[model samples]
Target: MTLNTRIEAAIDGALGRATAGSVPPKLAAALYHAVKPGGARIRPTISLSVALACGDDRPALADAAASAIELIHCASLVHDDMPCFDDAAIRRGKPSVHAKYGEALALLAGDSLIVLGFDVLGVAALENPARAGRLVGEMARFTGMPHGICAGQGWESEATIDLATYHRAKTGALFTAATRMGALAAGEDPEPWTELGARIGEAFQVADDLLDALQPEAVTGKPAGQDARLARPSAVTELGVAGAIKRLEDILSGAIASIPACPGEAMLAEMVRATAARLTPAHTATAAE
Candidate 1:
């Protein structure tokens, strides 16, 4: 199967097995709904890519780590789209969890997914205790308050913030986790892989910011202009369109350079270049026009 297809199948399978049995029917349905159908699956693909680059002996471990990362991402989306947060009515090209399942269930579903992410990671770690411990610690550090995505989300409430700090927490944290955890899952030292993820994560966030400024709801699958509307600090707001694209290119170049020569280096490089190109100003012109 293609890389994307493999990642999708792994995610679907993990979500299915996770939500099965003992979980309340309503909550299970909500969890499933949170991760349905399609997404770029970029985070998990990054995890799997890094794992393959290190070694492919434990695809299952990599899959578990990727699934856990995705669940956290999906859960974040559920909460982010709630009336309390972005108050967005749509997400992933459809009615958001709160819009479809009501505020209470949506909240619970997000909570459930967050807990499920830890659970999945716990199981993965058990099979390889030391590596698993490292993965858990990295994930916790990336997801917890004051330094992680949760803190990134919390930044919206702050009156003052910098673009780098904000984007690092909001988007880069999970991407960092995806790459690091993938390395850990493959029994590789995660330190070497950190820069690769950080660069890519920064690039991804810049692209996302550019998209928010230039793309439409139909294309982005989420409310566009929400960043500007909310006064959220973003690369586009801080650096304009052309400037943001330049920043993205610089970051992508750094990410490619960080990838060591390995079997999967080409694939990872391609993914980074493709992602960066997708974020360039020219690509946004058609969407803007």
Candidate 2:
């Protein structure tokens, strides 16, 4: 099956199970809305790609891992767009969950997806309990606590922030999980793939900074200049547009070299290049300038 197809099918299957029995109907629907029409599916794609590179001996496990990573990402977005956070009205070019549904439902939906993310890993646990267990632990480590996305968000409220730590936790955490989880899912040593994921995640954050700084809502499908408006630190804020763009180039520059040796190593490197192009905001700074 195609990569996108695999990711979607895995996601659909998980959601189907959640909505199948008696449940809060609105929240169930909100869960679907939050994830469907995925934005790039970057995390899952990396998960699957790393799995493929590692032979994907257990396809079901790999699929579950990818879907789980994506579910976590969707959950993060749902919470991020709530009134307490970015209060973004639009996500993936449509109303965010809290905007379309009520705040209570949106909050519930995000929490549900986070639980579902861990639940998704159960699909292959019986097949390889050891690998599945490792996947769960690794995912948890990156999704919460001192070094996860939660910590990333928590840093925002601090009196002072370490920009690098903030970016690494806020964004790099998941990409790191994506690569490691993919390798773990496929029964490979995940350690070697760490640098590639970190670099890609950092590059993505830089690109997102550029997007938020320079693109219009119409161009980016979400509120722009949020970094400036919210006083959130960003690449564009730290190092002007040109400097941020150059930094993006610098981050992506070493990504290929970081890929661990594997059969699909060349393919993974190519994917990073393509991702870099896509990361470039639609509205070029020069065009706006």
Candidate 3:
């Protein structure tokens, strides 16, 4: 099956299970709204890519892992757009979940997706118990506290912030999980894959920093100038536009260099390059020469 098709099927099945039964129609609609027509699907795509690169022994398990990662990501976006966080009105060019579904339902939907992510992995355990267990542990570590996205969120509430730590947890953790889990699912050692994911994650954040700084809501499909408005630390804020662009290039280079040996190494490298190209922001036409 095609990669996109595989991903969509996994996500569809998971969401269907959670929101099945017509008892709470609005909630189910809201859940579908939060996930349908997803943005990029980069995290899960990376997960599946790594699995392919490492000899996809258990594609079903990899699909579950990828789906779980994406569900968590979607959940985070739903919460992040709420009033308590970014307060974003638009996402993927549509009204944010809270805007469309109200705060209570949006909150509930996000929570439901988060739990469903693990449920997908748990179902996969029925086939391959050990690998499924490892995948769940990896997802938990990336989604929860101490060293995951939760830690990244916690950093926002602290008096002092460590830029690297915050960036890694907030953004890099899942990408890191993508690589590690992909390898683990493929029956390969996951440690060697960490640096590649970290570099790509860092590159992604830097690119996002640029888009958040320079791109319009029309182009970005979300609110612009968020970093400055929200007082969030950003590479664009720290390094300036040109400097941030340079940093993005550097991170992409490191990510390319960090790919571990595999039968599909060349194809994966090409995918990374293509992804980097997509992530790289074009210089605005109206900006100074």
Best prediction by lDDT: 2
Tens digits of lDDT, candidate 2, 1-289 = 9999999999999999889989988998899999997989999999999999889999999999999999999999999999999999999899999999989999999999999999988766877889999999999999999899999999988999998999999999999999999999999999998988899999999899888887778878898889899988888878888898888889898988898889999889888888888888446657435
Per-residue lDDT for 1-289 in model 3, tens only? 9889999999999988997766588889889999998999999889999999999999999999999999999999999899998888899999999999999999999999999999999999999999999999999999999999988988999999989999999999999999898898898999999998899999999888888888889989998898899888999778888788788888888898999989989988988998888887446323312
Give TM per candidate.
0.92, 0.97, 0.97
Flag regions of model 2 displaced more than 4 Å: none
Give the Cα lDDT of each candidate: 0.82, 0.91, 0.90
Ranking by lDDT: 2, 3, 1
Can you write out model 1's per-residue Cα lDDT over 1-289, one digit (the tens) per residue? Answer: 6667767777677677777778778777777788887587788878888888888677778887888888888989999898878998888898888988889999999988888788877877777677667777888898888788999989878788776787788889999898888888888888888888888898888888888998879988888899889877788888888787778778889999998666788888887777666556465755433
- Pull out the clashing pairs in model 1: none
In TM-score terms, candidate 2 sits at 0.97
